[model samples]
Target: MPRDRPAPDLPEPLAPLIDAHTHLDACGATDAASVAAIVDRAEKVGVGRVVTVADDLAAARFAVDAANWDPRVYAATAIHPTRANVLDDATKAEIELLAGDPRTVAVGETGLDYYWPGKLEGCATVEEQVEGFRWHIDLAKRLRKPLMIHNREADHDLLAVLIDEGAPETVIFHCFSSDANMALACVEAGYVLSFSGTVSFRNARDLHEAAKLVPDDQLIVETDAPYLTPHPFRGAPNEPYCLPYTVRSLAHTRGQDPVELAEASTATARRVYRI
Candidate 1:
């Protein structure tokens, strides 16, 4: 069952919010009417834009079509690391063409994930994952776009690969869950850390600490919606409308003003994604 919805409250201010990373395509939430409904709710809560990610070929087409239909929606294309084995030469060529679309802003939602062993059986081997990630990295660099990374329990290997291959012009670590040291390393490498609702959990002290350590310009916020709903609303189906709660929590951790945090994050999102 989806989580319970809490009584909605008016957000502090309707400053524009940008959900830097979200899987609108993969979550069975990418249709026009549904997308419009979600965007409307986001607009009501001050969210101005969203970068909907595609985890596979069919979804990539949906992402592009949706973005073309809605000016506020942007797209990111990549074969998710877990599904890397499915990426054939034809798929790669198609993705290259898709990446050239104006609305396709980044190249990812890709990286390594060892947490669910065998979950990607016959989908992608570790070598395939590495090769696919490197290909996307190169694509991002060539296209002069940022890369939205998803690293889950594969930080060390992921970092090593990025360092060795040299990442793209800009890299955003979405739903960052690594410890402070890894956070520091990423920051030092000139990467952006996008915090999610998980950072708002009471027991997420490590995330909070990492949030505090992240420089203002190098930080961004997201809902990773339909997942990682913020505290006080945990278990609920998350949407861009819930961003303010996560932003407020992030501000609290950094001892910054909520409005300022919102503005800075929006600007950072625009600058990074070139939206």
Candidate 2:
């Protein structure tokens, strides 16, 4: 849904934010024209770079293609935790090949998700998810790339696995919704926590607190676009251009200037994704 009115004016420096995690491939709103439109809108609000994550092989290829279509766009490839069962040998080989492409900067959106109790059709069990996660972790290590993880109600298992297996160059916990203790542990482990629009929700006081606890260097902001749109726009289809709202809210929570937050987050994003 398009905004009925223009977004509120951003401070001069906070205008050029970077959405560290988004999903153009999933949105089906990222064609040449749509990309140009999105970029234009983002630029108008100071959103400079967008990292689009692909969940499966087809989506991964689409992310690479979208990156090719726009200089400002970057791509991450992985088999999502929910779809971990689909990672057959052929698919694994294809993903391995995709990693070599320069546009493919990271491996994942892969981790564990135990929030849904029932077995999802064609979805992997926890054991299978762990195995798939390990495979992607190995690929990230071999490729010397960062890893983008997605954990939901499986923090203990996820942390245990990462600690035992070690991590790639960088491990980013995308859409970090965990509590402060886990956030602290992740920080101590040299992992980055990427906050999404969820942090802006009034009910997400815990997330706001976590944001405050996160070190500047270990913090990044994202839209997780077409998913968790920020407050005032929640439940609406999210887009990269809406990142400033989340950033603004994060800055407020952290008691930092919006421009400083933007600059720091952009730097952190670059460090993790090497974008």
Q: What lDDT does model 1 reach?
A: 0.84
- Tens digits of per-residue lDDT, candidate 1, 1-275, equal 23567534545655778988776754456578878777777888898899888888887888888898888899988888888887789999998888889999988778887765477446677887888899888888899888889898898999999989898879999999888988999999999999998888999878778888888789888878768888788866777777898999888888999989999999999899887
Off by over 4 Å in 2: 1-13, 117-119
Clashes of 1: 0
Estimate TM-scores for all models: 0.93, 0.93
TM-score of 2: 0.93
Give the clashing pairs for model 1: none
lDDT of 2 by residue, 34-74 (tens): 87677676777888888888888888888888888899988
C-alpha displacement of 269 in model 1, angstroms?
A: 0.6
